[model samples]
Each structure stands twice: as structure tokens, then as C-alpha cells.
Target: MKLPNPFRKREYQILTPATKVDDSILERPEFLPEEEVKRSGKKTAAKQKKGKQLEGLISYLRKPRAEEGYTVLIAACIAILFTVFAFFGMIQAAGEPSLTVSAAVMSAMLVSAYGIYLAVRALRDKEKDQLYTWVGLSLSSLVMVTWVIALLLGLTT
Candidate 1:
């Protein structure tokens, strides 16, 4: 036993014989400190988000005509042609008069539906072509209502 003093020189007692420690772990980047690990995780997540945004923007720019209304226009044209065929068939029907009338009514309804589609698309994209948007909406609405009225009249007669 040693007598305790107010202070003594600091001494390290050997608890065990010295052994080799693997210093290779220190060179590994994964052995980062706690704060560095947290910061890296946040940075990686932010980078991923930025990459995804860039990918989306790149894909959008890749489209040939992102705002083309050609599909709606083609649908509208088909509806018009079908409507005319229906009328001609009904007026000069050699047989199946109802078929012609029904065809006409269906075509009219299709036109109305296409018009509504165009209108909604225009509004969604906030299109600068205001006149075209209004025309599509009004034309669809008018054609739809007119067909409905005609259908009722045809049934009554």
C-alpha cells in the first residue's frame, strides 16, 4: 500500500501486455466521425433530389411537341365527318334508317366529348390561345346539347 498525497505524478498502470491494433480501419472512409456521417447523409439525400428534378426537366425538354393539340383536332375532324355521313345515310336510307340516325347522334356526342377534352387541356396548361380554348368549350357544349335535343325529337317521332 502507498500513502496518498495531496497530489502525485500521473502514472499509467499496465493492465495487460501490449497487443497489435489494426490501424487499417482508420484509413477507411466509412469510419467517419458521427457528425461527418450525419452531414454526408444529408448531402447525399439533397443530391438525389436535385438529380431527380434535373431528370424530370430533361425529359420534358425531350418531347418533340409538348403542347401539341393535333390529337384533339383530329378527333374533332373525325366527329364532323361521321356526323355528315350519318345525316346523308338517314336522308337517303334504303334500309335501316335508325342506324343512320343513331350513328349521327353518337358522332355528335363524340365531338362534344372531344371539345370538352380540348377545353380542359387548354385550361390545365394555361394556354395562350384563348380564342381556341373558348371555341372548343362552346362548340363541344353546343354540339352535345343539340344532339341531345335531336335524339329526343327522333324518339318522339
Candidate 2:
């Protein structure tokens, strides 16, 4: 004899789609007519135009004034001067008998890498201020100065 059925299954009746349902009965009585829909479309267009005008006014009010060019020029000058000094120092060091060429080269490389990183970051951040740009440019110029000095000293010997 088979052991009493260990598992009992529940029986469910299959459902068929309702043939008596009327789809029209589900619609609301306040349905918009075609003309009303067109009128609503026109209203939306007018609203969008008004929105754009408001945005234009807001932007004009919030826009920043032009920056002073002199500030940028000064920053650039400072960057250039520093770069020149750094380069001269590197060159003088290289020319000295006790200085190691490897250290000079490494310092130059580090300055160059750091300059590039700063420049890229400033650009990505949309930094319109000339200060960051000047700093980055100065750092990059310093790298060039160091490299040139090392080369000059190496060749002079």
C-alpha cells in the first residue's frame, strides 16, 4: 500500500476573460474634446515661451561681471619669474661638482608631473580665475627650467 500521500496539492479553477464587460463604461464623463485638446496645446506653448523669458531675465541678473585683465597679467608675470628662478637654480646646481644629476632629473620630473595634474584639475573644474592657471603654468615652467639646466651642465663638462 502506498504511504498516505505526503503532499496534498490545492486545486484552482482556470479563469477566462469577462465577455460581459463594457470598456466605454470605464471612461470619465468629462473627456476633453479635440478642440479643447488643441487649445490646451497652445496654452502650453505660450507657457513655455513665458518660462524662457523668465529664465533669460534671471540669468541676466545673476551673470558675473568681467574680470580685470591686469590681475591675470600680474599672475602670469609672477609665474614666469618663479619658473626662471627655479631653472637657474637647477642649472647652477648641476654645474657644481658635488651635485648629483639623478636628483636634479627627479626633481624636474616631479615638478612637471605636479604641474600637469594641477592644470588638468583646474581645467576640469572650469576654474575661470587666472590664479590657478598661473600657478600651474609656473610649475610646468619650473620643470622645463630644471631640465634645461641639467642638460646644460652635463654638456658643459
* lDDT of the candidates, in the order given: 0.63, 0.53
Estimate the TM-score of every prediction.
Answer: 0.45, 0.32
Pairs that collide, model 1: none
Q: How displaced is residue 10 in candidate 2, in Å?
A: 85
lDDT of 1 by residue, 1-157 (tens): 9888768886666886454542456533357676775865744655676799888664433333323245454555556666677767877876457765786768778776976777677666642444555555665666677677877987998
What is the C-alpha lDDT profile of model 2 across 1-157, one tens digit per residue?
Answer: 7666658675565796544542344332235465764765744555676799888664433433214323333444544555566556657777453344455455555556555555555544432444545555565666567567767987998
Cα lDDT of candidate 1 equals: 0.63
Highest TM-score against the true fold, candidate:
1
Q: How much is 152 displaced in model 2, in angstroms?
A: 7.7
